[model samples]
Target: MQKTFKLLLVILTYFSASSCDDLFEYHPNQIRLDSDERNLTATNLERLQKQQPGDTLRLIVMGDTQRFYDDAVDFVKSANSRFQDIDFVIHQGDISDFGMTQEHKWVQDILKDLKWPYLTVVGNHDLLANGSKVYQQMYGPLNYSFTYGHTKFVMVDTNGREYSFNGKVPDINWLAKELAPQQGEVWQQAIVVSHVPPYDADFDRKLEASYHHALAQSNMVSLSLFGHIHNWNTDYLYDNKILYHGTTTVKNRGFTYLKVWEGGYDIRRIAY
Candidate 1:
């Protein structure tokens, strides 16, 4: 009987130690990650490029997973169950709550289970602590553009408040160049995806007009997608043709689905 009790005690101790290791982290800001977790943007983009182009591009846009790991898990299941035709998924930013590398990893673990390849934008929270480096390491550049089918998707960093309004964020100049028409490419539309919208208070006030004007003037720009407000909103702030769509966070259990063809697109909000 004593031998049996000793064995049970040892098993209990081992389980307790394992639980502590999982529950408590050494440092929230530590940049520890496995090989499979690194360079996710480039890896996913490679997967995206391998797929054949379709007449209409279907995508899932969601963001602000933040600290909601459980919700993110449910989100992946819901997305996978509903979106078989989606070419890719775009996370509009704030993948982590405190910009902790661990949080980013937690969210990525769930997002990787998604059926389609996924990409992310840099958010204000994602710039906190050593998150900027971690983000660049885990993901790719803060600002990037890719063309698939008849559309060009531009993902930019627009978290001006995080930069303390240094006036360089949103990188209007780079955006202008990205939005410029490429020679010999018959691009029918452009969509700008960012964490903060130009009209938001977090956006650089000085660059707001320029940013809006840039999108308005760009003939190819059809829509802009954002997430930070934690709610769903759509409007034509400048009263022009460019439409801005802001999405709710995964914590709220919602996302946006976009279907685009050569000249037009449709958007539907899904709450799951």
Candidate 2:
């Protein structure tokens, strides 16, 4: 009888340990991650910088991956099958729904399967709970810019409503500075990318004109890209010179393919 009891205790102990390690989590908001999951922005940017500059820069623009794990996985498969000469994939934001680290990790796990490196913008939903911190830790800055070939991409944080319309969420000063020198020695074209469009009610009303004016006046900024609307749209809102492209959500199984050269760009909507 004592032998039987000892065997049962051993089995229980093994399962208890296993449950602690695999099944039970202390908290859903915990910011735990492996080395492979951290500092993804810099890692991907390094890969992007190393690629040869082609005449036509082909990229996949998709976003709003919130609460859509199954669809996001399918998106990876569809994106892979659709394009071959793509440079990289740009996720416009909402990497998480509840701002949970696990959601971000799940999305990353799926997007990591892509044959090309991917970049992300900070979405309003990504600011929930400890989401902003997790996003910063995993993807780098909320507002950042990088130049590839002759094109410079300026990604900013435009989730004004999330900040209660604090008027500083988009950081117009930083954007103006980034847009000031459009025709840099190396880069001649500029593209602004963000989550919430300035036209959206979620954007800070006070800064909307300034934001649009910044892009409109920039000789280098010919196009701006955004997500959060969950619908495809193309417009020349402010000056009729700057083209703004808004992408749909991954839940809708749609994305935009962008092709840009030195002087012009083209966009196509793809649904799968």
Encode model 2's per-residue lDDT on 1-272: one tens digit a residue.
99999999998898887735245567989887778789899999999988997989999999999999999999999999978999999999999999988898889999999999999999999999888899999889999999888898999999999999988989999998898764425888799999999899999999999999888777779899999999998999877788899999999999999999999999999999
User: What TM-score, over all chains together, does every model reach?
Assistant: 0.91, 0.93
Clashes of each: 0, 0
lDDT of 2 at 231: 94
Error of 2 at 29 (Å): 1.1
- Candidate 1 C-alpha lDDT tens digits along 202-265: 9999999999888878887878999999999998888768889999999999999988898788
Q: Which ten residues in a row have the lowest lDDT in candidate 2?
A: 17-26
Task: Evaluate model 2: give its TM-score.
Answer: 0.93
Question: Largest TM-score belongs to which candidate?
Answer: 2
RMSD each, Å: 3.2, 2.2
Q: What is the lDDT of residue 114 in candidate 1?
A: 94
Candidate 1 lowest-lDDT run of ten: 16-25
Q: Pick the candidate with the highest lDDT.
A: 2
Q: Which residue pairs show collisions in model 2?
A: none
